[model samples]
Every structure is written in C-alpha cells, then in structure tokens.
Target chain A: MAARHTRNIVDRPIWKSKGEASTVSFSAFAFLFSELIQYSQTKVKSTAELENRLEVAGGEIGRRLLELLTYREKAPKRKTRLLDLLKFVHTTVWPYMFGKTADSLEQANAADDEYMISDVNLALTKYISVPRDMGSFNPGALAAGIVKGILDAAGFPARVSTHYVDVPGLSKPQTTILMKFEPSVMQREARLEPRAT
Target chain B: MALIYSLYIINKSGGLIFHKDFAPISRVDLNDSLRLASIWHSLNAISVQLSPVPSCTGIELLEAETFNLHSFQSVTGTKFVLVVDPRASSVPAFLQRVYQLYTDYVLKNPFYEVEMPIRCELFDAHIEAAVQKYPMMS
Candidate 1:
C-alpha cells in the first residue's frame, strides 16, 4: 500500500496537486496575454473592438475559474448579495488570479448602482505599453471581463468596464474596473437585504 | 480492444462543434455525426421538458447493448457526449478533464470563436492524449 501510494504521488501531474495553489510564471502569462491582444488587434478594425475581444476571451476564463475556485474553497458558498459578490472579486478572485488584492473597492457617489475596483499595477497590464494612437485603450479590459463574468455568473448582472484613473502620488495610473449593476440586480439585492438580517 | 467509441461536442444552440471517432468500429462521416449531435441535442431538451422535477438536467447516461453514452453539460449549455464501452470506468473523470482541455486550448485560443467548430490543433492533440490515458476495462 505504501509503495502504491508513493507511486501515485510520483506519477501525479503538477496541476493535479490537491488543495495547493497552482500558478504559471508571470512571463509565460504575459507572453500569452500579449499575443491574445495582438491577435485581437488583427481581427478587429478599432481599438474598442480589440478590447471587446479580449474581454470576451477573459470572460470565458472567468466563468470557468468561478466554478474551479469556488470548488477549491474550503467551505464553498455562493455569494448571493451584491456586496458579498463584489468583496469576493476584490479579495478572493483578485489575489487568486493576479497574485495580489485590489487597491480599493468604492461605491461611486454619482450613482447608486455603480462601483469601482482599482488595482495599482494590474498584472495583465504590467508589461503592456499601449501605443499613443490607441488612446485610452486599456488591456485591463480583460480583467474587467473577468469581473463581469464572475458577477454575471453569480446572478448579479453588471456591465463592467475598464478605465485608466490617474491617482495622485502614483507613478502610473491605476486600472479601475467600473461595475454598474442592472436594475434587476439592485432590486434583488434590496429584496435579499431585508430578509438576511 | 477499443473501450471508447467516439466523442461529440455540441454548442448551446444545438450545433455540432466537434466530433471524433476513437475506434474503427464506430466511425461516422461528418454529416452523420452532425445530424446525430442535433438529434441528441433535441432529445436532451425533450428529456428536460418531460422531467417531473424542477431544474432537471437532461439525459445523462444511455445504455445500449454494445456501448454506453455518457453526456455532460456545462453551466453555459455546451454538451460533451462520450461513447464508451458498457463496462468502462471513470468516464465522468475523463469527461471533466476533456472539459478542462476545451477551456484551456479552445476557449483560450484567440483565433477560436465562441459557439463555432473547434479547430484547435492543440485541443485535438490533448484530447487524443486524454483518450489514451483513460482506463478502459476489456
């Protein structure tokens, strides 16, 4: 039995390691992600379209990751509330995907439904230096898509967009993921809030 | 002896995205496989509608004399149908791995489009390897 167990452990694939956090090298991911963006560029006519393509691709990853990560969690619980879902993305999802938590999570004063999650140096955008002609083209759109995928899959439908926000004292602008929940999501949240307590 | 017969992948809208025959016995032409996928898609939907319980997932396993069909559907409605020997073990685990491969190679491929026929060479190679790794009872 001991010999069989040892053989099993030795033969097991690296990715099949149970309960351990598996990660690919940043350089590997950076190369693949940059290639993804460049490929999207060739397919699309405009920068917006390229970003859209990247987001769609990231959404696919996010959707799968939601299931995989949640299953990996010790006590897997679905986040029904909007705030809980957002916190999950900020704290749990961000660190799992990007190796660090987001800088800030804030509700916009201008709108009740709008919220923003900002990262000082987004891993996806770290090596990416956007050309001047592609003005305001943030590769962070992929990250936005991931957030959208998580939220949408969790039953909190939201339109997530990426923006380059200039923060004082920071050398580079922060990548902010702006999430605007649908009216139905707000209504559901309100309905659930009264019942939770 | 080939324990697995074939594999079929159907998109959400009942379109045949991928089909592969592993063994020589169950070899199907492209048109036949496409039609088979659509027919199975309709049957799956009909099974759901006919179910008495709420949130009923469609037909999961179908047993025939010579072979058995195991179907797995993702949350996004993409269906994976595996045709294997009646005595095959660990089919679900194999299907799950195949789904993971699809996510890694097909969905992650920038050139690949959603809900389209999967033509990724990497996906094909990995799937072939996965099939070889699956343990089959003779």
Candidate 2:
C-alpha cells in the first residue's frame, strides 16, 4: 500500500522565531531525570558505576549544548582560553541548564591545574534519595561530566569529579565539581601567556 | 517555492546512519545510498585538502538541474545532507536544527550505540513532525 502523500513536510524552520523563549517545566525534567537515575541503577553493580553512566549521559548533553549555545551567540565566537571557557560555563552554561548560575567558581590553592564550581543544591539530585547502603553515590557526577565535556570540546583536556561539601550554616549539602587540567593544557597556557616586560 | 525532499545523516567513517524521505520519489536502494555516502565522504576530504584556508568546512550546497542538496558537517565529523527545492534559502538553519535533534534523540537514546544505524522512534517522530510543517512545491 502507498503511504499517504502529505504536503509541506519540510518547508518550515526548526526553531521558533522568538529565541530563548522556549522552556520545559522543571517538574517534568526532574521526573525524567529521576527515572534515568533509577534505570542506570538497575544496570550497574556499584554506585560508582551508576554514577559513571549518569556522568557519560550528562557529558553527551554538555557537548551538544556547548555547540548550540555558541552557534546561537555568534557575535563573539566561543571562548578559547582556559579561564574564559570556565567562566563561560559558570556564568552562561550553568544558568541555561539549571535556571541559575553556579554559587561559586574557585581555583584550588594547592594545585595550579585545579578549578571548582560549587552549587548549594544540585538540581538533578535534589529530589533523588539514595539508599543508605549505597556508598559515595553522588548524582552530581553528571554535572561534573558536563563540565568536563564542555572543557574538553573547547580543547582543554581535564578530569572532573563531583564532591559533597558541608558548610556550617547551610541546610542543604553543597556540591562541588573539581576539574583538574592535564599537563599539556597547562603547558599550552604557559606558552600563550604574555611575558612580563 | 521551497521544499525539502529528503535528508541523509552520514557518520565520520562514511557510514549512512540515517535517511528519511519527505516527498514521494523513486525509492533509493539501500546499497546505492551507502555507496553515495562513502563517495561523498571522500570528495569532502579532497575538497578540504584543496581549500585555501586551514580548515575546509566541507560542501554546503550542490545545485542540480531539478533540485539542490545542502550539507553541514559538525565538529565531531557527522554530516547532515538535505535535498531540497532549488530556491530553498533556509538550508543552513534547517541543517542546524537537524543536528540538534540528532544530538538529543539519537545520541541521548540509551539504547542507541554510537555510529550504528539509527533506530530511535522518538527521533523519527520528531523529524516527521518537523518536516510536516513545510509546504511541498507544486
């Protein structure tokens, strides 16, 4: 049997005319994310494995988002410098994904290659409750993967890990993503730095 | 005046990962489509070598007698090819949207393995719905 011939199936543009106006409800997102975590849990034998799977998923998203965001904002091309790229992720990428910028961005004192992005409440995990026996399960590993993905695409090779940090007065646990740049990135940055007169 | 007839998504290794026809036309044999993809990939690489610039972004358009074929390649080496009416001006914009959908539906699908033939129902639905809005050229 012949398929029905439909008209105008390929004429319209993909995005709406009003850019940045499209939005998805947070509840819907949270529900889907929770399901994703649950599904990953079923496939993994360890909490770390589940977290790794989640991180990989997040990294995929981060890579695509970085490209789309850069294409949408074309006045200035994407950031090339390490600090500028990190700042872009903190100020632009975080807000676009979670509705707000990360709480803080800091450099580790002991390591020149290390940088941190801290959030008071990690959005993906806020509604998720890990079992008591699941040791060191940090859902924010997804966010870490996201950061790593973004940086990696921008030519920065780095390792990213999510950690839970407790503050004296804060009611919610703060999540911190630590990114450690590879030696090659550091060497490239040193070579590109302007020499002191 | 403007219409898209078909779309083809080719992976980095010259594999035809996805193909969809929006308008009624002669059926394309699967083996022929695969051969065309690899040949096009080779041509794209040769074009890059012949380019004056350090990086060649690959072929963006091919003007044929009855139709036009527009293509866009992502940094990750995935190529999007759209066969459309000759007058179509939204080729770049449409290709960008297709790439976004590819990332969201195909790349994000837990069941989908990388560089494999695309089998995501959601991706197919999204593409079909998206194409339905365009009017066919009579």
User: Which interface RMSD values do the candidates have, in the order shown?
Assistant: 9.7, 10.4
DockQ of each: 0.01, 0.01
**Chain A accuracy as TM-score for every candidate:** 0.89, 0.88
B100 in model 1: Cα distance from truth in Å? 35
Worst 10 residues of 2 chain B by lDDT: B104-113
Rate residue B23 of model 2 by lDDT. 76
Cα-based lDDT for every prediction: 0.84, 0.80
Write candidate 1's Cα lDDT for B47-74 as tens digits. Answer: 9999998899899999999889999999
TM-score of chain B of each: 0.96, 0.93
Q: Write the per-residue lDDT of candidate 1 for residues A1-197, one digit (tens) a residue.
A: 34534655558553434445657887678658867776777889998898899889878878887887787666789877888778888888988887778999999999999999998888777645565577898889999998888888888888989999999998678999999999999888788776644
